[model samples]
Structure formats: structure tokens, C-alpha cells
Target: MKLTLKIWRQNGPEEKGEMVDYQVSDISEDMSFLEMIDVLNEGIIDGSIDDKGNYGPVAFDHDCREGICGMCSMYINGEAHGPGRGVTTCQLHMREFNDGETIYIEPWRSKAFPIVKDLVTDRSSFDRIMQAGGYVSVNTSGNTQDGNAIPIPKENADWAFDAATCIGCGACVASCKNSSAMLFVSAKVTQLSLLPQGDVERNRRVKNMVKQMDEEGFGNCTNTGACEVECPKGISLKNIARMNQEYLKASFTTE
Candidate 1:
């Protein structure tokens, strides 16, 4: 199949960017979206598709194309990870588009996640948010509690597991009108807050992480629910509710 791709191109963080169009043919419907891009890059590198005098290959992030890493984040056709439910860009297939369709691709847009190049944004803001307090500080120096020793309710365990599935893909932010990271932060908070291992620092954890999230320039969530809808892992909006409750409780209890 032949297709037209209008992709964003930027040289560096401070450089101006714009949409550049290219044509690709003989694409397999079975190929993943990234694989299709690979074909385009190949054409560009070989000067076969060089209409704009060879701007080099498009720069997009990808690792573990199986969708486990969430690194293949792309805003395609105005939707995060393209037009799909519960799937990352790497998992998106070429068949989702018509044979002669024109696809528009861009990177995640947020102040906190500034673009490093074409289609590649610096998401280290997420890493910083996680570092603020997304883990348990339990002493495991031979005094580790046995996994079976903790009598956790199955309901809580399931909810925590669901929350833990968040891959930090930033779709939650990209889809939000405000570019909020609330859904991502809430999922991180819920995963730990529901578990016994994370009980020790619950109040402080919420306080620190939320503070850091704000410091990172992420916008506040106004319950528009876009984050929950676009999340590749389907992380629920309920986690945001839980996070709010935790934050309020932490404000009162945490010094």
C-alpha cells in the first residue's frame, strides 16, 4: 500500500520545527507502525524519497517494540499512540489506516516534556517524579518480611496490580487539554499506597510526589477524563480520586 506521512521535524530543543510530508509505498498491512516508519527512514537514508534534500531519518523514541516499555510514544492523527484503545504506538498496526490515507505524526506536547528532537521529547520529568517518592523504603537487610506473611485483601491487591500496570507513557499528559500528569502520578501513588510494603511512608510519599509533580510544571487535572481514556494501559480515573484523598490526608497528617 502507498501512504502519505506528514511528520513533525525539529533539529534540537531550541530549533524551530515544522511538518514535512513524504510518500511511502509497498507497506505491508501486517507491519507495526514503527516498522512502517523504519521503511520510510530507509528510503530517506538511501535518497530514494528525498524530496526536501534529505533531512535525515525522523527521530522518534522506541525500545522493546513489544509495547512493554512505552518508549514508542507518538501523537498520530491528533490522538496519543494513534487511533486505538489500550495500545502503544509500537503495538499499532499499519492495517488501522486505509491504503492511501495521509497520517500526521507528532511528539508529546507539554512544557514539562520538552522536545529534544523530532518526535522525541525528554520525558525525564517522569523519572524525576518517580524518584520523588514512588517506592517503599523498607529495610530488607535479612529482616525482609515473607511475601506470604502480609495478609493483604485480594481486592486491594488487584487494584494495586492494576495501578502498577502504568508504563509512564505520557499519553495521559498528551491527551489532556491541560497537559496534566495526574493520571500517571495517581497510578504510581495507588500502586504503592494499597500495598503493605508501602504503608510506612504513605503520607509523606503522597506529599513529596505531588509537590514534585507540581515543580516539574505538569498541569492540574480538572476531571476532563481524557487521561483515563487515552492511557494505553487503561489506568482508571479512580486512581486520581484515590490520589486526591491521599494527598488531602497527607496534608493534614504529614509534617
Candidate 2:
């Protein structure tokens, strides 16, 4: 199959960027989206078409392409992770698009996620937020009870697991017009709120993480629900509601 790709090109963080067109042919329908991009880059690196020797390879992020890394975070055709629900760009297949189609690919757009290059954005802000307090300081170094030994309700366990599926792709932030990171933050908060292991430092974790999220310059969630719609994990807006409740409760309670 032959396709047209309109991809964003940027030299560096300080440089201006724009969409540049390229053509790819003989693409296999079974190939993952990133594989198709690799084919495109191979052509560029091989000097297949020398437009004054300036047509270079596209730079995008992908590691552990099994959809767990969340590094393949490009916006495609106006949707985060491209035309799919509950799947990252690496999991997206070429067959999702028709033959001879035109695709627009752009990086995650947010104040917190400044573009490092073409399709790569700096997501270390997320790391800082987690560091602020996304952990349970419990001591499990010695012989510990088996996970099943503590009998949590099935509903609570399931919800916690659901919230844990978040890959921190920032799709939720890119899809929001306000570029809010609330869904990602809320997922982290809710996963801990549901489990007993995470109960010890619950108040401090929520307070510090939320404070760090705001400090990172991420916008507020305005109930647009776009974050939930675009999240590759389908992390629910209910997590955000739960986070708000957690924050308010943390306000009145003293540790």
C-alpha cells in the first residue's frame, strides 16, 4: 500500500517546526505503525530522494513497543495515539488506515511537555511528579504476607488494577484543549487510594503529587472529558473525581 504522511519536523526545542510531506509505498497491512515509520526513515537515510540532501530521518520515540512504554506518544489525525481507543501508537497497525491515505502526525502539545525534537517531547516532568510522592513508604523488605493474604474487596482490587493500567503516555494531556495532566495524576492517586498497601502515606502522597502537578505548569482539568476519551488506557474521569475528593479530604484531616 502507498500512503502519504504529513509529519511535524523540528530541528530542536528552540527551532520552529512545520509539517513536511513524505510518501511510503509497499507497506504491509500487518506492520505496526512504528514499523511503517521505520520504513519511511530507512528510505530517508538511504538517500532515496535527495531534495538538496536535506530530507532527513524522522525522530520519534518507541521502546518496548508492546504498548507498555508509552513513549510512542504522537498525535495522529487530531487524535492522541491515532484513531484508536485503549491502544498506544506502537500497538496501532497499518491496516487501521486505508491504502493511499494521508496521515497527519504531531507531537504531544502541552506546556509541561516541550518538544525535544520532531516527535519526541520531554516527559521528565512526570518523573518529578512521581518523585514528589507516588510511593507507599511501607517496609516490605522482610518476610511479608502474600498479596492474597490481605483480603480486599473484589471491587476495590479491580478498580485499583484498572487505575494501574495507566502508562503515563500524556495522551490525556495532549487531547485536552487546556493540556491538563489531571487524568494521569488522578490515575496515580486513585490506584493508591484503593489499595491498603498505599494507605499509609495517602494524605501526604496526594498533597505532594497534586502540588507538584500544579508546579509543573500543567493546566487545570475543566471537565472536558477529552482526557478520558484520548487516554490509551481508558483511565476514567472518575479517577479525577476521586482525586478531587482525596484532595478535599486531605485538606481537613491532620496526619
Candidate 3:
């Protein structure tokens, strides 16, 4: 199928950007979104599509194209990861669009995720937020406690597992009107707070991560629920509620 793509192009974070249009043909419906872009880039590099000159291939982030990495983040047609539920851009298929259609693609827009180039944004802010707390302290001096030694409720274990599915894709922030990272942060918080293994630093983890989230320029969540809706992993809004509870308890108890 032939298609028109209007993709955002920027040389660097400080450089001006704009939408550039291109025409691509013979695209397979089975091709993943990133694969389709690969075809487009090939055309651009070979000077087949753009006759003016070699405009260079479009720059976008991708790793582990199986969708486990969440590096293929893109705002397509005004929706995060294109028009889909519980899927990342790498998992999105070209069949989702019709023949002769025009697709608009852009990078995640947020103060914390400044664009590094075309479709690639510096999501290291997420790495920093994770560094602030998203871990559990444990003793490893040959006296490590067995994780299975402590029996945990099935419900809590299931919830913790669900929260752990978050891939930190930033769809939660991209879809939010305020560009809030609450859903991502909350998922990380709940993933540990519900498990005994994470109990030791539960209170402190919430405090530091939330503080670092704010310092990273992420906006506050106002219960709009966009983050939950747009999350590729279907991370629940319940995690946010749990995070708030943990934060409040930590604020009062933890010095």
C-alpha cells in the first residue's frame, strides 16, 4: 500500500524542528510500524523518494524491537504509540492504517524528555528517577534470605507482578495533558511496596523517587487517568493511589 508520512524533523535539542512529508509505496500490511519507517529511511538514503538530495534517514529510538524495551516511543496521529491499546510503537502494525493514508509522527513532548533529534528524546530523566529509588536493598554476604521463605498473599503478589510489567515507555507522560510521570513512578513504587522483599526501604523509596520526579520537571497527576489509558503495559491507576498512600505514610513516619 502507498502512504504519506508527516514526520517531525529536528537536528538537535536546540535546533528548530518541523514536519516533513514523504511518500512511500509497496508497504506490506504485516510490517510493523518501525519496519515501515525502515522502508522509508531506505528510500531516503538511496535518494529514490527525495530527489532534491540525500536528506539522511530519520532518527528514532529502538532496541529489542520485540517491544520489551519500550525504546520505540513515538506520538503517532496524536496518540502515544499510535492508535492502539496495550502496545508499543515497535508492536504496532501497518495494517492499522488504510491505504493512501497520511500518518503524523512525533516524539514524546515533555520538559523532562527534551528531543535529542528527529524522533529521539532524551528519556534519561526516567533513568534518573529510577536511580533515585526504584530498588530494594538486600544483604548478600552469604546470608541472603530466601525470597520464597516468606509466604506472601496471592493477591498482593499478583498486584506486585502487574506493577512490575511497566516498561517505562513514557506513554503515560506523553498522553497526559500535563506530561505527568505519576503512573510510571507509581508503578515502580507499587512493584516493591507490596512485596516483602521491598519492605525495608518502601517508605524511603517513595519519598526519594517522588522528589526526584518533581526535580526532573515531570508534572503532577490530577486524576485525569490518561496515563493509565495510554500505558502500553496497561499499568493500573491503582498504583498511583497506592503510591500516594505510601508517600503520605512516608512523609509522616520517615524522618
Which numbered prediction scores highest in lDDT against the true structure?
Answer: 1
- lDDT string for model 3 (37-71, tens) is 99999998887888232347999999999988989
Task: State the TM-score for model 3.
Answer: 0.98
For candidate 2, write residues 10-38 as lDDT tens digits.
98999999888888998999999999999
Error of 2 at 105 (Å): 0.5
lDDT by residue for model 1 (98-201), tens: 99999999999999999999999999999999899998987879989897798999999999999999999999999999999999999999999899999778
In order of listing, the candidates' clash counts read: 0, 0, 0
TM-score, structure 1 vs. true: 0.98
**Any runs in candidate 2 off by more than 4 Å, and if so which?**
50-55, 141-144
lDDT of each: 0.93, 0.90, 0.93
Position 130, candidate 3: lDDT: 90
User: Which stretches of candidate 1 lie above 4 Å from their native place?
Assistant: 51-53
- Positional deviation of 192 in candidate 2, in angstroms? 1.1
- Please give the RMSD of candidate 1 to the true structure: 0.9
Q: Residue 128 of candidate 2: its Cα lDDT?
A: 95
How does model 3 fare in lDDT? 0.93
